[model samples]
Target chain A: MSAPPNRPVFAGLTSAYPRSEELVRATRDLDRGRAGAGAVETLYAASEKEVAALEERLFTTITGGYLRWNDLFRPIAESWTGFSVGPLTRWLETNTFFRQPVLAQPPVRVPGTVAARLPPVLGQRPEKARVLLPGPYTLARVLDNRTGESDGAVVARLGALYAEELAELRALGFGTFQFTDPYLVREPPDGVLETATLDAYRTIDAARGSSTTIVWTYGADPTPALRTLDRLPASVIGIDLTEVEAASLPAGPEGVGLGLGIIDPRTTLPENPVETVKVVREAVRRRRPSSVWLGPAASLDLLPTKPAEQKLLRLADILQALRREGVA
Target chain B: MTDALFPTQEIGSLAKPSLEELRAWQEKVPFVDRLGPSGPDLLRGDAPEALPDLRAAFAIAFLESAGLDRVYDGEARRIEMYEHPIRQMAGFQFLGHVRSWDSKYYRKATVVEPVRLVRPYHLDEFDFVRDHARRGVKLPITGPYTLADWSFNEYYLARQPGWRGRPQRWAAQREFVVDLARQALRPTLKALVDRGCRTIQIDEPAAGTHPDEAALVVEGFNEATAGIDAEFSMHICYSRYEALLPALLEAKACRQWAWEFANRDSGDHDPYAVLRTLREYGDTRSIGLGVVDVHRDPVERPEQVADRIRRAASYLGDPTRIWTNPDCGLRTRRLDVAYDKLRAVVAGSRLARAEFASSRR
Candidate 1:
């Protein structure tokens, strides 16, 4: 199954593809003195080979130029969250984990922060590289806020720091950025914090200049926060439709794009392609979004690598089926 | 200053491997850089105690070197908080793997048969610490409620005679927990007490995670410690303490409370915000203040920790009801980092102890 001729549907990871447990086990062997460090490289190289194969099977030409850069994993963000990123923090209400980016002082852009540490492959499709980073407000929420500043102060500081990092990524040739903020959806801002959070996103968006910014929210429904998020001047808004009924999605802003995450990364159960199409069609029909994309409801990192891989394969088949139906 | 605040005990887990302990594999795998050297060995059971003790010795050494007033074997004998207990309990099988935060997975177990203790789990480790410890050692037992909360209840649920509804499910869950409390926690506490163990901390992280089950948590604690005499504690973190409160007041008599504070200390978020409820309740339960952070490996300044103790004391309106500790376990850190952080915990505790004692006089 494939898209309509000359159709423009894009299929890609909204966040980092999972690092396989085999690679982790191999790395563990290196750590335990049972194997040489080169073993890790060998295994990781093989893992990347599989990732390349999956990308080949699933992604479309509209997304062909954005393979390796399309999904910058947690290591990049954790290692470069401008502070000594803390130990892996558990995602509340779920079984998944993330190495929390500690906000000791304001997060800053040091000389070699993330952008400088890019693998050689990141440069190949530099023009269309889609880089993922924690959004300013989300980053602030997870931070070990060392300063006794107000939430607004923390948000502004984080927004400025994220701006600096995004600007650096932009300078390094990354054009599309997905700033993830799951907190906004899980607990929409009320009263004064809402205004501050909105202002903070505006500051971050302004700093990116011409680069595309897709502010993504997961872990909760985005319906209530839609109005506030729409005013941020970002190019796109990514919604997690896993929890909310597709019928409940609001008719959104005219110019901003909408990406509906229809795939469930938590389980290996095959998603019905027909039902998925209906969800997408309804979102498009109701929201009248300027542009639309299909992806998973949240970071695929939450799943074990096997389930994540299966979900990706399933997603690929569904997209292929959608394409065969000539419904881009 | 409301009375005695002299002792400082570590919350549990002192696992920090030095860089030298890591294998000679580097300069290769780009992704391998994220994992610390405390990798595979972290999931296994007690390596036969090397010399005086294997993993326990290093932990005791650090706490001792830091000059803590109380200590433990640092939970070096166990793999992690959940499975270590589940492994020793009969009728539970390794069901599958579950994430222990992120990336890291713990072997999740389920009871396919009736629950029973294969043997006393904590005594051997406790004996080692008891022999070598310079101060009082606290043995941390994973609480009955947490053991029930974390595990899948195959054993109890299957035996229910009819259609399993919400109430039946709840009954099955409670039966499994209380059964474990009778078979595991109570017996363990009795054995430890019989061995002259004076302080036992029942870790109930799951209690705080699910507040709706607070009563069961308290029930587990009460049943586990009934007729058994010791300085007991209920340790919890990353929870909504509000839900546990009022109810937590009931169980405070059986044991003092040890909680994580520093890691949750978000500037204006005020880590000590819960002390108000504690103060309002007027039950003078000793509060274990987590002065050191376990979330990050960064060693805090000694003064930073001292300031935290002072702040906790001030808010509780009583200087004497406080104890200094790390926010949680130190298992994820590098060895040197854990040592340095504990040193900070000790130093900071000393500074605050002197100031607090003097201020009261």
Candidate 2:
């Protein structure tokens, strides 16, 4: 499960890559009633395959690309009982938006819903493939909880559902599960951080059997929550390097992996490999943890297709350079 | 303009014509055929040259029928708000499409060098709209703050490699926005004013994206329209209006704050509570109140629109300072839906005016 000496593993964050021009056109046509759902699904499948191929070459861990997802919460919102997709809310500060999940009642996991939403395994080794989900804390923060339950209760319920989803995915042969918690860093709710948040992570960690769990936090600095996040029972803790300095990062608990977000996905400006290497080296030198996962600071969906791919290529180059120098 | 209690205007941009709609318009207005043949290929966007005049004529006709007091040609000649201005400006290159919401995307660009206007970008569109329109025209221009926030800034970032993180980002953004105001937007506004443009609406929907940079938005607005001789208003929608306010109060050159409320507040109860934030911040400028929700297909009842205006008026304490409009542009709606929405606004405005006159008696 460990990366080889002096080499850091690379992976995509929670979301899909930006849709290609052909896919964009197909989706648009479907919106305009010029094309059918089947036509758009065909394009989605094609796009997922293209992304899987690219990730297979550039990343140590592969992703399903989540091409069918309109937003992070859509599949769960649509499939799960007692949850409905609401109006478009801006996703953090980015131009992109997600349909907020509105809770009518306590959520119930409908069997095969998460499985059906997942992409068909596109020829990658099963152990190297990862599925991304919104962490319970983030899901609780973003959702309109009309269930009339306390925030803690909502987190606990969502945590149980995510755990079940992770267990099912693990049985289906995925080896890595990344729980994205952008809201946990951006705006953590009162009191839940001390109790429900940590318990939710524990619930998910207990369910993930022999599979690696990554808690990726982005869109804000995680310095204040680093110690609390380090105590979670996850394998790796990802922080957005674009939002914080390398020197500011503290070392995590022994044996916990470090997900070093070296590339910024929001900007179109290409990263200089040398400058990225310096950041990785400085971060590694300071927060010398058990392992390293080098990747973009946030979802690549914010970028255009070409720039998103170029960023991965640049990350690959940075990883190679790091390996050559025995930096990690 | 009509001497009404609440004037009605659209927040620019009607729906672009479908091929069938274009053909129908050509048949109705025979002069449209003078521009080019009404063919299917024209609707595919290949014949931008032949379509602008026809499109403007159709839009003006539509607005005239809607009976709004203040009207523009629905920005028919231009592309979507962002790309239309950025395409004409120097030092920017179209990168690719970025999603704004579900199934909706815009072609975003990168700032490769210092940004400047290539020419008067909106002159031809303005001239066509002015000559053809029967009502008073209100032009909507993309503001510099939005242009800087939306684009990828390489030129500004490249200037200060030594500085790092948020400080560097803020500094570069300030320089880029101010430069855009000085070099591009100021000239465009001045030219529009010189060419007899009366009311210019500077659209800056990205103003509240960064709450910390609210002052930056105000600075950009003030810088762009500094010496321009015209009535300048600002239209910001689907944003954190509360965050932009206190800071937006600093925009001295801006005469009105045109903002969207109907989209967020469903007009059920105390729908204009957000308007209280403007009053709290001492923003006493004229308010372009958004009473129609443009995102939905079902037409809001004239009573609902009037109710919204009445509630907003209670907060402003002056119906004369309020102008009624949709939450944002109707470009997102179908053509029929957009027409119905505008007609509803006009009807609602009349109803409110009648109520105000009765109350005075």
Candidate 3:
């Protein structure tokens, strides 16, 4: 039986964007004591505006570009209780590194930490904004868990903290939240991860009132956790098409949306829009998702400014081709 | 092996030279002007010929003054470990900077064609160090596996277009790494050995990046140092050392394993837990035991360093099998910090030696 065709929406970057040359210079200057805090802020604001304008042109959902964030966990690590920034650790197989969060005690969310870190432009169009966060599973896996809690318990606690943050963000008019879980696919799926993942998402789902919740997994193959992932409480389940073929994507739960990671963000080579649309069509046909979001397979921070921008433009081109073909 | 118990050596790299320091060395070293313009700044693309040699002289003097048993030029002649070697090789073009961690960026390159060594990248630097240094020298070269892992492989991926999966990528990576070992690193190692450089440390921080491909590390090492007659050691830092144990044990050419344990475990609680694990896996190779943390600013007391050596000694069952050093390259630390850390290592080794003598009595 042929699966029904579904129209897909464009979701811009679900993680940090590569810093522009000017922003990079400003950051270095700030680090070297040549530039003041205000000067750096000015540059960040300008970059944030440019990013917002670019996303407004191409995306159905927009982000603040995460220009100020050093890494995915930096903001939380700096502001949250019981966590401190530790030594540099490799982020999966990539050359990039993140300061691992050292948890001394149970994690507790500090009020307004997320909002303060976010670009002010996000507040103006909260209805269209999407906030990217590190998923509980990934956090529990990456952090130096010194709280003496089991991995499962740590995941649950982090999920509860995120749940509170989500409730607050939802009240602030944010429309979508993407929780990236690279660790889920990197490590083998066990009973502990499966149970903890479900429980954590359940907590996040309960707190997120009317806002879209997405659980996006990348960096490694997500095939092993497909069964557990299909049953996630999130509104959308994202899979890296670069890692798994489009045809191999199993059917998702009824009424669940799908985030199709069709573009490869790690490489500088430009992807063909026609070929990308074909992959999206195949994934939609197999998964039979209620809705879809087209995006990069992972974070765009690994690439340079020119290549990252080109990747986004390619995504815009793919969307246009999809529209012409009556797929979206 | 040195006659001294708990012989100390530098891991690699001292702090980078300041502009004033470079100028001072240029004035002092008479041959600096005759060396001609070389060593292109990877980021800016300007050749500063005399600067590198002068920098090497400056670093060698520092290490010798610190009283280390084995010392190199502190990698002062190069831009960094990755870019310096890649810039000297063929078929690579530098892309923009990529962040390694907070506020730190390394110039990354892509393999556009089959890579080959243009010349022995470290020979000039080694020659300068040999002329200037009073202490025994161990030249640290970036290993073939690390070079392959750090680079983006455009050439090999293009070779097999049909095999499109993780397995295919892995296959391409293996081919790229092996080719590097044979084509690039082997010739380089041979030239260094021919130059009367006895001890060569192959720095492979990326050795444990892929646990499944641990065999590739062994294969690369063996291929690079295949016919070269020299004492070879493998230096791997800030990695999953346990994952590479089986392959590490198989790497017969690597007589010593210079690994970083101080940064993670300082012998405070679970004293040298990873060392215990390595020994349990039947590892019998000499260890370059890291006693001081390079990332931290506070200097470790000599007694604290002795305690770390003592704990590692307990696991190895032989003090002679242990060599004292800082966790990794002191390039990350300040100049004063690196100097103090090195002094601590030297002092700590001496303390450990005295304690061992007393126990025997």
What does TM-score give for chain A of every model? 0.84, 0.94, 0.96
Best by DockQ: 2
Q: Tell me the tens digit of each residue's lDDT in model 2 across B1-361.
A: 5577898887879887854577765454433433346533454455657567667777877777787777787888778888888888889988888777778988988888888789877988888778867788899999989888888877888776842465667788899999999998999888988889989999988886676688998999999999888888999876667666688888988889898877656312254777787777677788889888887788988988888899999887778889999888898888778888988998988898899999999
Which digits, one per residue and each the tens of the lDDT, describe model 1 over residues B283-335? 68888788877867678998888888888887788877777777777776766
List clashing residue pairs in candidate 2.
none
> TM-score for all predictions?
0.69, 0.90, 0.91
Q: Write the per-residue lDDT of candidate 3 for residues B1-361, one digit (tens) a residue.
A: 4798999898888777665655544444332333334322221233455456556766776676677889888898788899998988898877777666666766677788888879877887788777767788899999888898777776786675542345656777788888889888999888888888999999988876666677888889999999788989999877777677766777868889998877766222343767877778877788998888888898888998898899888877778799999888999887767878999999988998999989989
Q: TM-score: which is higher, 1 or 3? A: 3
Stretch of 10 with least lDDT, candidate 2 chain B? B27-36
Model 2 agreement with the true structure over A1-328: per-residue lDDT tens digits: 3333544455454566788878888889999899999988877877787788888877787775776678878878999999998755667655667877888899999878877777775334567777777788888887777787877888888888888888887777778888888876676544655488888888988897889999888877778777577787898888877777887777667777788777776567778777777877777667776778877887787777888888888888887787677675
Span of ten consecutive residues with least summed lDDT in model 3 chain A: A1-10
Number of the candidate with higher lDDT, 1 or 3: 3
Report the CAPRI category for model 1.
incorrect
In candidate 1, which residue pairs get closer than 3 Å at backbone N, Cα or C atoms, i.e. clash?
A1-A320, A2-A323, A2-A324, A3-A323, A37-B25, B16-B335, B17-B335
